[model samples]
Target: MDQAETKEWSRRYAGKRLLRSEILLDDPLFQQLINTSYFTPVPSIVRNYFQTQCQRCGNQKRSLFGSIPCYSCGNVHVYCRKCIDMGRVMTCTPLYEWTGPEMDWPHHSNACTWSGELTEPQRKGADCIVQAIQHREKELLVWAVCGAGKTEMLIPGITEALRHGQRICLATPRADVVQELLPRLQQAFAKLEIQALYGGSRDREATAQFIIATTHQMMRFKHAFDTVIIDEVDAFPYTNDPSLPFAARRAIKPEGTTIYLTATPRQQHQMQIASKKLPHVFVPLRFHGHPLPVPEYRMCYTMKKDLATYRPPKAFLKWYHRRKHPERQLLLFVPSIRLAEGLSEQLSDILHDCVIQAVHASDKGREQKVQQFRNREFDLLVTTTILERGVTFPAVDVAVLAANHTVFDEAALVQIAGRAGRSPNDPEGEVLFFHDGKTEAMGAAVRSIKRMNKRGGFR
Candidate 1:
């Protein structure tokens, strides 16, 4: 097209259009052109028009209201026509949208179609969280029960953000949780770009429209999102580290919103909400279309000092054998990796054709082990709290060995119990806390879960 035609087309297509041209900074012809033209006097009016320093390059030079040739690099610096249209130049580079409003972008249409009904409290809490996000609140704490569909409730907020052209992140503290969420989220947001980011993920840094990551990955992002949803907000890394909170805040835009989903909010966060310092919502029911199973705690006080060295507690072994089904699996939660491995070794010999597997955070084949557990290849799997919140295994009975372990706090115990009855077909399952002695925290955990269930009419 001729210069006149080009100018007319540019004018017609004016406001902040994304250009797809390569900037030639080092081409011989462009360099020569710039070198020869660098000395040419910029019009006095243009010289004083307005100056802008390149944010990336830090070059302070004369600025024009339109695309001008860079004297140093010969790259074209396109300017917003509004300034030129108004016949005024400014000192700052005009901000333009390379892409139109986010809503214009195509999004994945997958959504939760599960027909399960939420209890009244669950519904109210979920609605509160959704409303907070819709209004762009700074922070919200979703305090729900162990089995409440905290992740599922965030679906509406995620969909709304995607439809509005906003970027979102669902970050958890565990990789296994990230894996469990991928398929569920994929099925929900089928049309949108969804990427699961973690250490072993192939697309760790993929520029997806939606991201589900672990808490550790939060540090890599610097103001890269519009909405940040931290699932298991009260879980490890997130609740323990002040830095993770700072990183989470920094990951979002200045006007961005954050949503914290957890069955158990930390004491500090709870105190803040109690004092009306932080906004809060509460979900007291499970989403499996049923009430949460009240865990039965039994003190299997054996005189044996080392539970691993002695034969597995007779009562615990009895419960395991009775609950074991050929097609069903059981998860045995031990206190530490050493105990987990020792139990796995001992249990392997007692049950015929029973594959007892142990998994921990530092285990090399953690992913493979989890996959096997999910596939029901193993009859029983021994693990630490690593499998607590993020994993879901239907038709599995859970046994908490040494439940009084300090690490098995209220939230951890609740989450561990949650793994038992996730599937509707397996809505009820056994959760036994084989403790040597009952601790106050254990009583609190049981009471907390029972209260939530009672409030949700699960009794």
Candidate 2:
């Protein structure tokens, strides 16, 4: 290949392993490049005497592999079913990557353009992050409370990484979080080239030095990033799924720094911190310098019964009428999609003057509905646990209809209650948990909030 052709194609293939079929360039050019010494071809799936492994997603589960008749190789091919949604990775398939010289990333003098100042706690955490990145630490956990301006604290560290010409990725577990973080990061570093990758993002074809992508998208990259910041490290499916962590580990360089940001850490992480095995930074206070609103427990024996009868619970209605701030918006959380859709209609009918909407994970217009609620086009929003984290409504009273349900784990409950009291102007917005009976998760969530408040110096 010519010098210009080699440089342009190498930029696209660097640190990324893709199937030969995925390259969209002319066949002659692709063949020419693949024939050169700069390209390395690897088998997509490796099989040994005992086990099989998928190089893309790092999936080794024997149960997730299936055999299919192949036309290209004329043999029975085994493919990984776990990450088949991204693409079918079969034994016969090969992944091509550029093993050539690294591209020169642009350097910015003032990478961060955010005008807001960080709080004391935030600055401490930011300093810790900068130190970890500069030292190239293997791992660092940022244990901060919800609404503690976790994103703002990363600006300094990210600015440092950019100035040093290091490629960076801020990966989260969910697509919604990816969508929400893109605009904020873009606005903060308006002069830099940034790309946000999700299932349906239009920027998939564009290459950028900075990337914001879902953890699932990380499967497509191998040894790509210098700094990988995992936002909402406690959120699902990241917490439950093994492949996502494996993908994240494979996506970053061997010596890359991995920073985990979370409000509620898992028990394993907590133990590691307590044992002084894991290095961490703690930020107890929020950006507003107010304690998190501890949720009040109310007995709603008729919560499920009222939903069964197509009506709102008496306790919920009573709380709604109390009017601590009736003009503020309401975020009502439920356990399932059925409850979210049912309660929105019943509550809208009872309160005729205000607009109401319901959203769940499966809803195609979930993003649009959330945007409308953020714009104050709707007064009440009924949702499932999908909105329990990574979203902020400045002034809203939060409630959970069946807070004792099995789906409302400790982490979920803490994140749900954190939806309220986010804005400094309305720092004391209320939160309520209406339940048939108290659960261990509920009690733990309450205790966790109180402990955080105590650390914030609130009596």
Candidate 3:
């Protein structure tokens, strides 16, 4: 080939041969090429042609490789032109490495000492995870009730992977959860290189042997890990997106192990267990050795009769006032943002110097509210299902307003109840579900807890 021909071939070959395993956009050559008009800029298309849908809205219009500027965010994203027209940018990248030469594993040392020695239930849960890791199982469903020390149960498996020098990724659907787990995982693998990746995570450039990231952040990972653990597997975003399952699968080696941790598996997951398609492990109790609190069902009846006249039931109000602890906190869960806001306003009027804050998925002050809750600045937090998982407020009482609301499914209801009575100092608390009528979900939730508690020797 002539000189010009040779250079052209080299550029083409170099670009095509670039490993899709690394999702980092900081590579100088990759950035230059991405900026170059000749090369299409959508990494999702460049990595996974099957993922042509917009990550944000799941719209499939325009070329997967089309380049468009987001009118709303003023950010440039490679998405279908229709998505851009609709003013939504893809929220995830599809780049993932399915296979490559094995990478060197790093040494790991556990930093978090077992607060108390593992109980028998914890040990059993740990054993199941360890077995799955050793067997290179496709999936393992961990059925543990709330406060079961599910994170701690994974320590053995994670430590085993770390000891073998394997790269590990622990992903959850929520950023707050990613933050909540960072310290625990750090303590679990103290001497190992650990990177926590999320939207606002600090070390974007650092690649650690172990990573804890929000599920949305998994789009940035190419086949960069050997073992992947999906915590809160039944949570939102992850459960809603088929792409995340594909992403998690793509993020691992062909022989890599996958473990799922969730207290409440969906119907499909349950079916898998029934058919013997997936190995299942059950931990029916909390580590603190207490029964899951059974939520009492109280129908307001008035809620549905007059939608515009909704208010906390007099019974609920009296209970709230009577049991209100000045030092401890309370969490009131409502079905919708409108209800949460309305209740917060009314509660503010009833209590003095009692800070009542409203939190929802779209609230920009979410982090601040969470921090304030952690710092004990808020006497009460009125929220939606966003705080259903991965949040703990010791000695806090919990009330579910309109518990029969469509949003409070069995898993969600169980998780909401789990939020209370997590600390040993406050081993027990009340969970009241105020609703217009009883739901099958409410009965199931109560029964699920009762069953787990019975199995755990707590009943």
Candidate 4:
């Protein structure tokens, strides 16, 4: 390879597997890379690859990876629709991985200079992670409460992984978390470069020893990390779709291991622990050693219908006017994006000196709005469940406007209640589940919170 060409390829596509069809401009150079020993080709489409599982995402369902007409290649091609959003993969499409030295595992350093301490329970969880990584254990689940210093619990394990020269990737379901975790990890592991990957991300150039990325971005990787830690394993995007776990699995080396961290997990998570599919650590206490806030259920039988008339139920309005004060911030969780906006407008007119805004997936100014809310520039935030998981505000109270909706499942309800009483300065706060009628999910969520409190012996 020519010196200039080698430098260019090493800098840009060193660790990437790119589709030949996806590369329109650098065809000649890429071909030269293949002609040399720097790049190698792999079949884009495989037959019953992975025992009828989609090799890319491990989808074994015959329906998902079924055949589709490929007008691009003038033939029928079995392409994985599950991961089609990443790129098109057909019978004729060819994928290439860099076989160059630049893509080597230790291509970056393993040195780190972090010296943070973990809480006792956190240290126990952290030690379990180190064991899982050292032994290459297939699965490990950390069931820590929302404010249980779960992120801090990861430090000792991360340090151990780096000491043994293991490459690590922390994958989360939300981009907001990716943004949040990166800085903290970077600050802690001062000697290592950590790259954060998300949609429209700008940190593609760094060959990081530690990579913090969204589960969606994991699809672009193959056999990459030695230890893959999936934080908030049961959160959105991953919860809404089944393919993300497969992607996280696919990104790990054959001898690598996975660690799942979550406050609210499904029954299947419990099943995995029981069936010996995954070793587990349960930490019911937060770092502050305080009990999780239990929700207070208030019934508003006409709320679902009253929103259309832009008239909130008399019961709710009365409670809001009485309980909500200017000194305290509030997070109002509505089920739908449309409802969040409508509720925000209605609340603005009703409340005085309260600057309220709504945020959701399609909201272009979502990040900005969240920052403004965090800075105390806004008195309240009306949001969909998108904000249900990774957001925290000091002494903020939470209210679920229509908690009886099908969207408020047991796990969702638990996570929503978790939004309140997170900051230690405000160890206790209000969590209201305003429902039209009680459902099993709401009852279960309340019981679960009380159970945890009893376990902690917090009155």
lDDT of each: 0.68, 0.89, 0.72, 0.78
TM-score of 3: 0.79
State in Å the error of residue 256, model 4: 0.9
Q: Which one wins by lDDT: 2 or 4?
A: 2
Flag the better candidate by TM-score, 1 or 3.
3
**Which residue pairs does candidate 3 place in steric collision?**
96-222, 96-223, 97-222, 97-223, 105-165, 112-187
**What would the TM-score be for candidate 4 when compared with the true structure?**
0.86
**Candidate 1 segments whose C-alpha is farther than 4 A from its true place:** 1-126, 204-206, 303-310, 321-328
**List of clashing residue pairs for candidate 4:** none
Question: Which residue pairs clash in candidate 1?
Answer: 102-165, 103-165, 108-191, 108-192, 109-191, 110-188, 110-190, 111-188
10 residues in a row with least lDDT, candidate 3: 9-18
Go through the candidates in order and give the clash count of each: 8, 0, 6, 0
lDDT of 4 by residue, 1-459 (tens): 677766665645554566765444377876776788787888765675354545455556677776777776678778777667667666667677767765434432345456766777777888898898878888889988878888888887887787777778998887888888888888888767789988878975435768898888876677777899998878777876776877777788888889999987778887878887778988888787788988998988788688776555677767777884437788888888888887788878887777889899899999999889889998889888888787787778888888998988888899889888887777877888888889999999998888877766676
What are the candidates' C-alpha RMSDs? 11.9, 2.0, 7.1, 3.8
C-alpha lDDT of residue 281 in model 4: 88
Error of 3 at 76 (Å): 18
Using all chains and alpha carbons, the TM-scores for the candidates as numbered come to: 0.71, 0.94, 0.79, 0.86
Error of 1 at 251 (Å): 1.5
